[model samples]
Target: MNWYVVYTKPKWEKKVAERLNAIGVVAYCPLITKESQWSDRKKMVQVPLFNSYVFVQIEEKERNRIFEVVGAVRYLFWLGKPALVKDSEIEAIRSWLSVPETYEVAAEQWKKGDKIVLESGPFSSQSAVIQEVKKNHYVLILESLGCVLKVNKKEI
Candidate 1:
């Protein structure tokens, strides 16, 4: 399978994807859940990892299948050719999608944190290491518990 970038009309990305999928075209729109705040309230929405474009996995020969979808203006490439997303890049994306939540970290983000478990739960006495930094929680590996724990760092 090959990955091609599709250009959607304005905010027609979701519309283009739906129409494309209905026509038997395989399109992969990486979805990331995020907290969006308006003037009155805050809500969550699953937004496209890349705005206005989606990756498609399909055979190279079936080019016409792409343009057939409504709101799909054209493939994102120079000189009227389809662009291919690297296999490694897509694999990295898949790895990210496997997680329940995601976070964007700075360059100086600490990887190894030797923090004492502060909660009054079962593993409260355990000293843990930070497994990963997620949006709402930090994944910890408790030495005494011999298990992974996801606790909200903010709440702690």
Candidate 2:
């Protein structure tokens, strides 16, 4: 059997994955624990790392049955056929999430000249290079516009 990508309804990845597993479909929904904060307190929440995507190990014959599950929209197709995910890629995700702290810290260990991409907000989709790293802020040089800006660690 090969791993295929399944697109689920918005915010239904975990729920869809549970239903798939109960029906004997081997589904993998990768999650990441993020520190969420309200005014009073902070807590960690397990959120789907890939948002609406889930991986299912199955044969091509089982496609129709898999799509019958609630919230399962369809398989991700590439060039008119269902895309297959490599086993090594799945294992890499598992190993990375196994030691989540290491991954978080490694992202923060930015050295000068390291390339970084803005993940969200107004400056999103913009690529910048590290000019310097301060206590908790990064000085990035937006080369395309010839601008230097200070951004918080979380912004990247």
Candidate 3:
């Protein structure tokens, strides 16, 4: 068996998967829920990670029969031949993106114009507003203005 990419109409991946399954064609569509908020309201919706694409697992002989399905517009290929995506790679990404793992990102401080100074560190002499703070050290967004920069814990 091999996997082939199928391009479906917009927002129709689930529908295509359902159709394929009913016809005994194996299909995989990984979905994720995303939240969006605006001044009016907030909504949570399910969206496919790979837009307009669905992966189908099928026998070599079923190729022609599967192609006739509606919304199974075309196969993703390279050099005029269908490209097969490894199941291991797909599974790896699925596991990696899963929320079971724990990760912590420290909060950021200081805007572009805010004054900053490193209270105690090798970079003490330099001062800059916290453009962005990663594991440690501020990006110094306003370094161009040349202000007295101090990267204190409070301004980090």
Candidate achieving the largest lDDT:
2
Per-prediction TM-score, please? Answer: 0.59, 0.65, 0.61
Clashes of each: 0, 0, 9
Candidate with better TM-score, 1 vs 2: 2
- lDDT of each residue in 5-99, candidate 3, tens digit only: 88888888888888898899988888878897889999998788898898888877787665666777777878888878788756644654664
When sorted by lDDT, best at the front, the candidate numbers are 2, 1, 3
Scored by CA lDDT, what does every candidate get? 0.71, 0.83, 0.67
**Weakest 10 consecutive residues, lDDT, candidate 1?**
102-111
Model 3 CA lDDT for position 13: 88
Q: Candidate 1 vs candidate 2: which has greater lDDT? A: 2
**By descending TM-score, how would the candidates be arranged?**
2, 3, 1
Best by TM-score: 2
lDDT of 3: 0.67
What TM-score number comes out for model 1? 0.59
Native-vs-model 2 lDDT?
0.83
| Candidate 2 stretches greater than 4 Å from native | 103-156
